[model samples]
Structure formats: structure tokens, C-alpha cells
Target: MSIEITVSELYDLKETIAAGLLEGLTYPWEALPKIHDFIIDLGESLPKDIYEERGEYIWVAKSAKVAPTACLNGPLIVDEDAEIRHCAFVRGNAIVGKGAVVGNSTELKNVILFNKVQVPHYNYVGDSILGFKAHMGAGSITSNVKSDKTLVVVKGEGISIETGLKKMGAMLGDNVEVGCNSVLNPGTVIGRNTNIYPASMVRGVIPAGSIYKKATEIAGKREGYF
Candidate 1:
């Protein structure tokens, strides 16, 4: 097995309220279909003082700042101190972790964003799971569907996993940085602390602690890089 492709390798479960849901699965994308039900069950257990049920199946932390102009759908949760900026569209089946930022015009659907993650400008993230502290630069987006609408397949060095679904987006490991205007193609898996170049079209599984220039041009990061 490629350890980097597993849920335990890509994310710190403690950083998310969805830890219980994610922990039971080997791959992060496996949690996508369960997010709706998980949020409903979890929201009922959240402390009343901190989290408020805003609408049917929607919970928002009292400390989180949500813009009045934002369009939020059900089966969603915004954790403590998070920010949902102006006109952000949350299309349901989502979790925004503590201190995370969903910036202006960003759209989310069926996603789990771990603590302190940021998709802060004009981003469209769907059917994805972002690990702790991952940041997507302006205009970066996850392309969740293949052109032919076939089942997504995860492929990487000496590893292949058949994900029996047609709509799987990128899984970004902890502290991954996606540069401006980048597009993560369907079934993409980026590893921990890796950096992606701006405007790049990325696919497949990129290893941890590397810099991606292109599919054929990847460079390992210097030792001790934070």
C-alpha cells in the first residue's frame, strides 16, 4: 500500500470534527457520501452554548463570522472562529473547521475542510477533503468530474486504487499549498506539505514534501522546510 494515499497519512484526524467519520475509512474520498448524515447526527450533540442550529441540518459556531450575504445550504457546519466571507456559497454536505476561511465568492459542496484550511477566493471545491492548514490560492479550484464521466481512479507511484464513483475531487494533505489559478483534476491526491505551481493543471497522486512544476517535472523540497 502507498501510505501517502491513506487517510491516516494525509490528514490529522484530531484537526476535524469529522474525525470519527473519517477514521473509519481508509481513503478520504470514502467519507464524501457520509458527510450529510454525519453532520446531522453530530450537530445534535454539539454544545448549545457554542454551536447554534441555524437551519435544518445546519450548525454554526457562535464565534464564527458568517456574512449575511452568504448563501448557506443545509447539512453544513462552520466551526469555531471560522469565517464565511461575503457571497460565499456553501452548497451543503460540508464542514468548515475551526479558524478556517471560506473567502469571498468561494463555493463548497460535499467537502470537509480541516482546521485552519483556506479556500479564500473564487474557488469551487466539491467532493473533496482538505487536510489541516491546507491553503488554496485565489482562483484555484478542484475539477471534480472527468470529461467522459467515468469512475474516478487514483493512480500514483506503484499504486492504483479504484474509487467507484464518478465525482471525486482532490484530496489535499496537511499544509499543502496550491498556487493561484491552479486546477486539481479529478481524483487528484496531493501529499503533505507539497507546493503546487500557479496555473498548473494537476492530476493523480503527488508525493509528500515535494514541489510540483508539472506532471513530468517534480522536485523534492529541501530538508526542514516548514
Candidate 2:
């Protein structure tokens, strides 16, 4: 049997409380359904001094910066030093990690952004988990639902993994960089230390340490220069 990409290999659960709830799951998509409950539970445990409950299950850290125009709903936690920029919309069940940036016009829902992650500049990230320091460039978005409205599946090297989810999104590993205007289709899994080219439409599993120039043109990391 082929070795499946476990959650531990692609994410550090300690970074976000919601991610920790997915301890035994093999795929990241499995955590999508549990986000709402996880946030509600974690929000109750956050320290009052560091986090402030702002109606319902919405908890925003004292030190986090949120623009007045931003609309944040319940079951959300914005960690310390994180920035929710102008016009940003956080629907619910979102844990914006420490020092992360959700920039102007960005929309987030049911997502866990690990520490230092950036979804800056008109991004739409829903039902996804962005690992530590992962960054999505301007205008990039995660296409969370397929046109057919069926359960999402992840395909790898001649192997298929059924996610049994209708609203799955991308699972971006640590240090992954998605370029401008890219669209990560439902059930996309981008491994660690990978860089995707601008305007690329990506789907399926992209292995670690690779450079994705396009959906069909992926290359290994480059060797050291002279």
C-alpha cells in the first residue's frame, strides 16, 4: 500500500486548537465538518485577558488589529498580532493564527490559518487549513465546491482518496507559496516548501519541495547555484 499523507506530516496541530481535533484523521479535509464545534470549545477556554468574546462565539485577541469595516461572525478566534484588513469578511469558524494577515477584501470561512500565514489582497479562503507561514498571493482563491456538487476526492499518483465531503477546500502545507490569481480547486493538497506559479489553476496533490509552474508542469526544487 502507498503511504498516505497524514495530517501530522502536513500540519502542526499545536498551531491551532481546531487542527488538534483532527488528531487521527489521515486527510485534512476530514476536519472541515468539525470546525464550528472546535472553535466554540476552544473559545471558551481562551484567557479573558488575551481574548475578548464579542457576541456569541466570536473571540478576538486584545492585541489583534481588525479594521472597522471588517465583519466577523461567531465561532471565530483572531489571535494576537493578527490583522484583519479593510473590508475583510470572516464568516465563522475561523482561527486566524498569530501574526497572520487577512488583507483587504479577503473573505474567510471555516479555515485555520497557522502562525504567520498570509492571505493578503483579495483572497477567498474557505473550508481550508493553511499550515505555518503559508502565503496566498493577490486574487488567489480556494474553490471549495465542485460544479457537480458531489463529494470531493484527492488524486495522487494513480491513487484516489475519497474525502466524503461536499465543501472541501485546499490543504496548504507549511511554507507553501501560492502565486497571484491562482485558483486551488476543491480537495487540493499542496505539500510543504512548494511554490506555485501565478495564475495557475491547481487540483489534486502537489508533492513536497516542488515548483508548480502549471497543473501539468511541476518540477523538483532547484539545486544550489554556483
Candidate 3:
């Protein structure tokens, strides 16, 4: 099988607390529904000295910086040294990984952002999983629901996998960089070490280590990039 959009292919599980939850799961989106209960269970086990419970079923690392203007709901865990900027909205069932950044006016729901991921500035991410160090540029967002509201399906080259989810979002692999104002359509899977151009409307599976300029134009990274 091609190593394209599978859980193992898209993420380094060692980077998140949801590692065990993702194990044996063929697709990363499979873990979306399990995130809520998992956070509650995980929060209860965190050391009191390091993680402080804010309201019900919420754990915020002592070292994390959360702006007073930010709104954070339950079933959420903000990891060590992460930053939740002013007016950020975390709508629950979310895990913001160590050293990650949820910047000004960004909204997140039912998502897991691995270590050092950044969704800074005017981003709306829902029902998604962002791998280690993935960065979404300003004004970029994940379009989580289709206008027709049909079950989401992951479409790759010569293959299609039904996700059976009506509210799925994008899955961004490690070190992926999405340019400004881009929109990742539902069931979009961007592979590791790839770069997407600014203001692009992206969908389907983008190969690992590639540079996506447009739907018809994608090129592999330069030899020295690796």
C-alpha cells in the first residue's frame, strides 16, 4: 500500500499524548470521535503540580500562556509552554500540544495539534489533526463541513476511502506549511514536509515532500531539502 494518508504515514505518534489512541488506526481521522473522552481520562492522570484543572474536565499546563481574553471550554488540555493568544476560542475536545500556538482570534474544536504546531491568526480548525510542527498561515482555515453535508471521503490518486464522517476536516502532516489565506477542504490530507502555496483551495491527498502550487501543478522538493 502507498504510504500516503494513513495514521502512521501522516504523523509521528511519539509527539502527542493521543499516541496510544492512534495506534492500530488505519486513518488519522478515525481518532476524532474518541478525543473528548480521551482528554478527560488523560487530564485526570496529569500531575497536579504541572497541570491545573480549569473548570470541568480541562487541564492547562502550568507553563502555558493563556490570554485572559481567550475563551476555553471543557475537555481540553493545553500542553507545556503553549500559547493561547488574545480572543482565541477553544471549543473543547481539543489538545494543544507542547510549545504550540493558538493565536489571535483562532477557533479550534475537536482537534489535536502535535508539538510546535501553529495556527496563528484568524484560523478556524475543527475535527482535525495537525502533526508535529505544522504551521497554518494567516487567514487560513479548514473547511470542515461540505455545503451538502454528505459523509466525507478521502480522495487520493486512483483511490478513494470513505471516512463515514459528516464533520471531518484537514489532516496536516509533520512540518507542513500552508500559505496565507488557504482553505483546506474537508477530508484533505497533506503529507509530511510539504509546502502549499498562498490562497490556494486545497483538497485530496498531497504527496509527502512535495510543493503544491495548484491542483494541476505539484513538484517534489529540491534535492538539498531533505
Candidate 4:
């Protein structure tokens, strides 16, 4: 498919504090390895009145609600109005954006969740960049690694990008809605406003404004209701 799923195409830079990190990169996945050092550098600049340094290089916005049971590691930023719920595990190199929700049992690693993004309930997102308002349903997860442990390659019809990274996950564009119990395979990229059906096994680049019923059936939003 001939599509533009670049980082700038998929996300609004205004939605995340990690915008500076992504701005220097072309593809969203390119930001993964840099997230660790980026978070450390960015966290230091955050105003003390707005955000508090909790642990080693971990910044939590005063307006954010983080449950006491949540486990947070270094190089993590929880932005304003974000909610890190009970038993949430933030494994580090993660940014929980403004008004975003990281619900119970959700695990995040090396991910940038843009404003209002929600990965609530039984979700595991790693080495991914979720755009503004993207929402993953309960039990949905991003499978970041290949079984054989080689580099991840983003693939779509007429498109192939060799990422040259062993760990990479889904890239969900703005307002994308991933259905429940779905598994987004490594290097998956869902474009803006796309919706994947429940229990779907999705990989490759799903075009913007499409409804993915299955691997064989992808219909534009105008064709049917989600």
C-alpha cells in the first residue's frame, strides 16, 4: 500500500511531552531505543511545581493519580491528569501522557503514550508509540518480539521497512481503537482513526480511517460502522 505513516503523519506533536524526541526521528519505532535517555533529560526540565521527582529519574505530575500499588521504575514520566491504576507496572523508559489511563494490570515499557491514550486492563505495551487519544481495549496487547528473535520489519503491501531492532511493537496512530483480546504483532502500524475488530491478530500497516475485520478484509470507515 502507498501510505504515509510517518511519525508526523500519525501523531500530533502537541499531544505529548516526548514530541521533541519523536521530532528528531522519522518513523515512530525509531524513538524506542532513545526513550531511556530522552526521559532522563526531559524529566529534569519539568517544573518542580507541576511534577515531582519520585524515584531515580522518575517524574510524576502532581495532578496525576497513581495508585500506591503501582510499580514504577526509572526513566518514567507520568504527565498531568494521567491515571496509573492499581497494580499497574511501568517498567521504565515510558511516558504516560496527559489525561491518559494506564489501568489495572497493564504493563508499559519503552513506550510513549500521547495525551488521552488509554491502555486499560490486562494490556502489555512495549517499545511502542501510541498517538493522541488511542485506546486499546481490555486484554489487548502488543507482541513486541519475533519468536526467532531477529530484527523486526514493518511490512505492508508495497512497503517494507527494516527496523534493525530486535524489540519493536505496534505503532497506533491518533484516535486508533484496538478491540478487546487482540494481539498486535511486532512492527504493526495502525493508522489514524483505524479500528481493529475484537480477538484480531493484526500485523503490518492498517491504513488510516479503515476498519480491519480480518487479515483478508479491510474496509474504509465510510463503508460501514465499526
Candidate 5:
């Protein structure tokens, strides 16, 4: 039997928790339900010299750049050097990693974005975890709910693992590049170093070091293409 992909396989736990509140969880999504509570716990521990509580359960780093037009709700942390572009809306329960970009018109909720991750356009990322350097091209978004509104199932290599949740979104691994105008369907799990072609509708699991050109066409990463 093939070993199923878990959150640890795709994300560096140390990095993801850099600004997060959860301490121990087997799956990334397991942390979702506790995000709001955890933020309240962690916000109290933030150093006053580096972090400033902007509102209820919301902490903004002293050096973070937040545009005047941006709207940030509570239970969130904007780390040092992170940029919240004009008109950005961070609903809550989000940890924007250092040097990350939450771009103009972008919306985020119940998400953890690792350092250097970029969603610098009109992106809607919710109930997800974006790994280090993972970039969502303009107009790319993660669709967290299934059309049928059933619990999500992650399938790869002919095996399916039930996630037991109805609202699980995409898990984008480190260095994953989601091309422009693409939609990552519910329970999508793209492995490390993979690239999704522009305007593609992606679902299920995309293996590591692969290029997803379409639903039927996925190619292994060429050695020299790196």
C-alpha cells in the first residue's frame, strides 16, 4: 500500500508554526477549528516591543506594512516585513508569515502562510496552508467547499483517504507555483516543487516534482528544468 501524503510531508512544521498558535496536531486542518482560540492564546504571549495588538485577538508586527485601505479582523498575526496591500481583507484566524505578501483585493481566513509566500493579487485563500515560497498567481484561488457539500476525500495513486471534514481546502507544498486564473478545488493537495498550469482546474493530489498541465496531463519534473 502506498503511504498517503500527510501535512508534515508537504510543510515544514517549524516554519508553519513560526507565527501560529497550535502546538501539536497531526493534520494541518485539525488546527483550523482551533485557530481563533489559539490566536487569542498566542497574542497574549507576543512581545510588546515587536508586536502590537490592533484589535481583539489581532497582533501586527512593528515592521509589518499594512495599507490604510486594508481591513484586518481579529485572531490574526501579521509578521515583520509582511505586506498587506491596499484593500486586502484578512477576515481572521490567519498567520501571515514574515516577508509574505497579501496583495491588493486578496482575502484570507483560517490560513497559515509561510515565509516568502506570495498571493499578491486577487486571491481568496481560506482554510488552507501555503508552504514556504508557495506563490498563487493572479486570480488563482482555493475552493474550500465541495460542490456536493460532502466531506472531502484525498485521492492519489488509486487510494483515497477520507479527510472527515466538509471544508478542507488545498494544501500547497513548499515551492509550489499555482499559475494564474487557476482554481484548486476542495481537498486539493499539491506536493512539493510542483507547478500547476495557468487557467487549470485542479483537484485531488498532484505528486511531488510534477507539472499539472490539465486534469489528464501531468508530467514528471525534468531534471534540468529546476
Candidate 6:
């Protein structure tokens, strides 16, 4: 099996409480279904002084900034110093990591956001795992369900893996930058430090440290002081 989309390959597990759960797991998407239960379990162990249990199965850290207009559902945890911006709709089963930003009008469901991840502005992220410091620009959305409603499949060059899930979203690795107005099709797995251009319709697996211009036009990135 390829290591490109694996938990160890795409993420720094030390940045998330799911670290222990991800151990020995090959793929990062394997943690998606278990997020709700994991949050419930982790929420119970959090210090009462730091995190407040809000209604059933919801824990919000005392220092986190949540706008009054934000609609937050249950089985969710907004970690310390996180920001839930205006009008954000979090529809449960989410773990917003520390110092992360769930920005204005963003909608999230059944997702695990690693520490410092930013899904700011008009975004819909569902059934996905975003690695640390990943940022989605304005109007970017993850199209979780296919029109046919069949099980989602992860497709790569010369390989296809069945997920058995009707609703699956994009998996963004650490420091991945998705530009404005982009639509990430279901089962899109972008590797670490990749950048998708604005208004792009992205699908399948994009390798790490790449700049996705189009399906046939991916470029390697050079690191330097710029």
C-alpha cells in the first residue's frame, strides 16, 4: 500500500488527541467514523476548569472565542484558544483543535481538525481530517456525497480503494493551502504542504509538496526565503 495518504505520512499525530487511535492505522480516513466517540471520551477527561460542558456531549474550552451567531451542535469540542467565528455552522461530530480557526459561515460535520488548522470563510468541511496548519480560502468546500449516493472510493494513479462510506470529504494534509472558490470532490486526499489553485475542481490523490495547477499540470515546489 502507498504511504502517501496514511496517517503518519500526512499528519503530525502529536498535534491531536487522536494520536493513540491513529497508531498502527494505515489511512487517515479510518479515524473519521470514530471521531464522535473519541471526542465524547476525550471531553470527559478534560479539566473542568478549562473546558465547560455545554448541553449534552459538547465541550467548549473556556478560552476559546465563539461568536453568538455560530450554531454549534453536540459531540463537538472546541479546544483552548480556538476561534469559532461569526455564523459558523458546526453540525456535530467535530474536534476543533487548539488555536484553530473555524471562520465566518463555515460549515463542518464529522471532522477532526488538527491544531492550528484554519477553515476560515464560506467553507463546508465534512467527514474529513485536516492536518495541522491547513488553510482553506474563501468559498472553498468539500463535496462529501456523490450524486449517485454510492460508497465513496479513493482513486489514485493505477489504484482505487473503496471506503464503504456514503459521505466522505477531502483529506488535507499539514500546511496544505486550498485557494478561493475551490471544490474538493469526494475522497480527495491531498498530501502535506500542497497548494491547490483558486477555483479548481480537485479530486483523487495529490502528492506532498506539490502545486496543483490542474490534473495534468502539477508542479514541484522549491523551498527558499522569498
Q: Please identify model 1 stretches exceeding 4 Å from their true place.
A: 1-3
- lDDT of candidate 4 over 109-195, digit per residue (tens): 999999999998999999999999999999999999999999999999888999999999999999999999999999999998898
Tens-digit lDDT string for candidate 1 (75-153): 9999999999999999999999999999999999999999999999999999999999999999999999999999999
Clashing pairs in 3: none
TM-score of each: 0.98, 0.94, 0.98, 0.97, 0.93, 0.96
Better of 5 and 6 by TM-score: 6
- The sequence of per-residue lDDT tens digits that candidate 5 reaches over residues 115-213 is 889999999999988988999999999999998999998877776878888888888888899999999998888888899999999998888888899
Each candidate: RMSD: 1.4, 2.4, 1.3, 1.5, 2.2, 1.9
lDDT of 6 by residue, 72-182 (tens): 998999999999999999999999999999999999999989999999999999999899999999999999999899999999886699988898999998889999999
Identify the superior model by lDDT, candidate 2 or candidate 6. Answer: 6
Clashing pairs in 5: none
List candidate 5 stretches off by more than 4 Å. 1-4, 18-24
lDDT of each: 0.94, 0.88, 0.94, 0.94, 0.86, 0.90
Give the worst 10-residue stretch by lDDT in candidate 4. 1-10
Ranking by lDDT: 1, 3, 4, 6, 2, 5
Q: Which residue pairs in model 1 clash with each other?
A: none
* TM-score of candidate 6 relative to the true fold: 0.96
Model 1 scores worst on lDDT over the 10 consecutive residues at: 1-10
- Once fitted onto the true fold, the runs of candidate 6 whose alpha carbons sit more than 4 angstroms away are 1-3, 223-226
What's the CA error at residue 135 for candidate 2, in Å? Answer: 0.3
Between candidates 3 and 6, the one scoring higher on TM-score is: 3
